[model samples]
Target: MRFIIEVLLSGLAIFLAALILPDSAASVDGFGWAILAGLIIAFVNATIGTVLRFFTFPLNILTLGLISFIITVLMVQLTSYLMGSRFDVANFWWAAVFAIVVAVIQMLLDGIFGAKPRD
Candidate 1:
């Protein structure tokens, strides 16, 4: 139940990102694409993302934890690549912007839903 809600919230976050960002920055075909992107993002974050974070801990600490956003940007880029035409990011800068938007949405949702921090 909680997992389902988190997935749906992720979908909403991606939908919000697609709506907020300009087409030049990022693009999503529609709600269906957003939902698919959300699922991919969640899966990648849970699996590969964890390992990457662990390995990059030094860089993360050196940057005062700001490097996590770059990791998020990479995850978004990976989702865009895996999804092909359905999701596209213009460039790394745009991916970073989109990542920030998604992070903000996630934070807001977590606050409202009282979801515990993952780490």
Candidate 2:
């Protein structure tokens, strides 16, 4: 249930970001593809992101977690490529912007939902 909610929220965020970002196009299918893409991205990030973060822990620490931004961009690019859809983003900068927007929205949602346990 929580996973589904997260994916839906992410899809909404991506759709919103697509509207704001330049040269970024998403389908007009009422966010169906966006929802699917968001789910795929979440799965990939949860599984692959964990391993990548573990391996790059030293760099992550040195960069003060900035490397995660790069990872997010890569994940978006990977998702776009895998989808093979017309939802094209112009370049890496736009991709970065999209990632940042999605991250901010997701963070806000996560905060509101309090999915993570307090320390």
Candidate 3:
């Protein structure tokens, strides 16, 4: 199903983040938890992130869209806390870096899967 594929893709993103960021730690043994965390993250980003972005449109514009990284880090921290997973990211900076890596990996996967429409 699409949902299952998305979850797996998210887990792959998390794994890639863990691999790419030295300070970001994730356990392969916690794949189920990672999937659940990813689902929660996707839901929060879809709902809360959308609302926050709308309200912070001015800041987003002023920052040239850089503030999105902060939002992503916060969402990741929230997901980690909610899941009670041992996956540990040291600080906001590390979280941001990890998030960027995850985003890149996700985008690459989406490209490979042709999930995103080509121009």
Best by lDDT: 1
Model 3 stretches with alpha carbons more than 4 Å out? 23-29, 116-119
Q: Which of the numbered candidates is closest to the native, going by highest TM-score?
A: 1
lDDT per residue for candidate 1 within 56-93, as digits (tens), equals 99999999987777787888899999999899988899
Give the clashing pairs for model 3.
Answer: none
How well is each residue in 1-119 modelled by candidate 2, as lDDT tens digits? 76677678888877777776655433313478778778778777888887888899899999999888788777777777777764555557777878888778778877887785535
Alpha carbon lDDT of residue 5, candidate 3? Answer: 85
- My TM-score estimates for the predictions, one after another, are 0.85, 0.79, 0.80
Off by over 4 Å in 1: 111-119
lDDT of 3 by residue, 28-95 (tens): 23666566667878888888888888888899999998777678788877776666645666666666
**Number of clashing pairs, model 3?**
0
Question: What's the TM for model 2?
Answer: 0.79
Record all residue pairs in model 2 with backbone atoms less than 3 Å apart, i.e. clashing.
Answer: none
Number of backbone-clashing residue pairs for each candidate, in the order shown: 0, 0, 0
